[model samples]
Target: MIKDELRRGIIHENPILVLALGLCPSLAVSTSLQNGFGMGMAATFVLACSNVIISSMRRIIPDKVRIPCFIVVIAAFVTMVQLIMKAYLPALDKQLGIFVPLIVVNCIILGRAEAFASKNSISKSLVDGIVIGLGFTFSLCILSIIREILGSNKLLGLKFFPGYEPMTIFILAPGGFFTIAFVMAVVRYLGNRRKGA
Candidate 1:
């Protein structure tokens, strides 16, 4: 049962590819593997910590002000992650830039608080957060990999095909848009088939 919650986050309620939440980071920071990893990890840390804290405080939080409370909690954690990244991983910090701060508004974090963490046990909420965070991370990584390989003809800055010309478009902002859109379409198609079968 606990494992199922984690699985649901990755596939059923996927923050990016499925629910279409957090697309800003999904498209923006995915230009390189390092950027994607940094954004993903930062998001994961925020999501997991926020969920645990919110789940623990659910009963005491007034319904009318719950949204504000969740934002405060999420922002605090996002700031902490931002500082840690800046201090420990300066290069990645530079690569991610504004997206790190923007994690405060990433819908996946607040959505979990309102949809899952508020009602679930602390342990379950923690698992859900981890799973969802990983799902988002994996989705960005895969999309970046596809774009980088096809658009740049390189992986991690080492040329995979030195002889071939890079597509260039895959590395541009427009490429990111179409790549994710295409991937999401494929995911929805497969999801529908699975349900039908």
Candidate 2:
């Protein structure tokens, strides 16, 4: 059961690549490895904390007001993340900007709250959050790697191949879309091939 959940989170239901939950920030902050990882971690922390809260309060959170309640919980966690980032990771905090606070409305968190966390046990919800969060990070890392390497000719701000001309396009919005679409197509192709085998 745990293995299936892990697999689902990493591949079958990846929040960005598979489920396509958080694309706006993914495209925005994935220009570099630092930004990608930073945003991913911030969202991960918020998702995990919010999941635990929502799962524990599932029974008492009235259905009519549950959405607002979930947002409140998520917002609280997002605020906590902002404070921590501002205090310790100011550079990253600045880099991520509004995207950090935007995690409050991230569909991944809300979707998990309504679809999985709200209905599952605290332990399961917690695992789901971490797993899905990691999946989100993984997608960001992939995009960041491609963009940083080809678009900027650097990795984590250090040039990989000295004097190489950067594509520039990969660091822009169109490049992000192209990269994501290509990655999705490749993923789907692999899945189909595996099933055929």
TM values, all candidates: 0.89, 0.92
Give the number of colliding residue pairs in candidate 2: 0
- Candidate 1 weakest ten by summed lDDT: 1-10
In the range 1-197, model 1's lDDT, one tens digit per residue, is: 75786678778888889999888767777777766777888789788999999999999999999999999988888888788889998987787767878789888889999999999999988988899999989888888888888888878877777688888888888999999999999999999999999
- Residue pair clashes in candidate 2: none
- Regions more than 4 Å wrong, model 2: 88-98
- Per-residue lDDT of 62 in model 2: 97
Report the error of model 1 at residue 1, Å.
4.0
The lDDT of each candidate is 0.86, 0.88
How many backbone overlaps does candidate 1 show? 0
Please give, for residues 49-133, the per-residue lDDT of candidate 2 as tens digits: 8999999999999999999999888888788778988999888778887788778767888999999998999998999999899
Off by over 4 Å in 1: 88-98
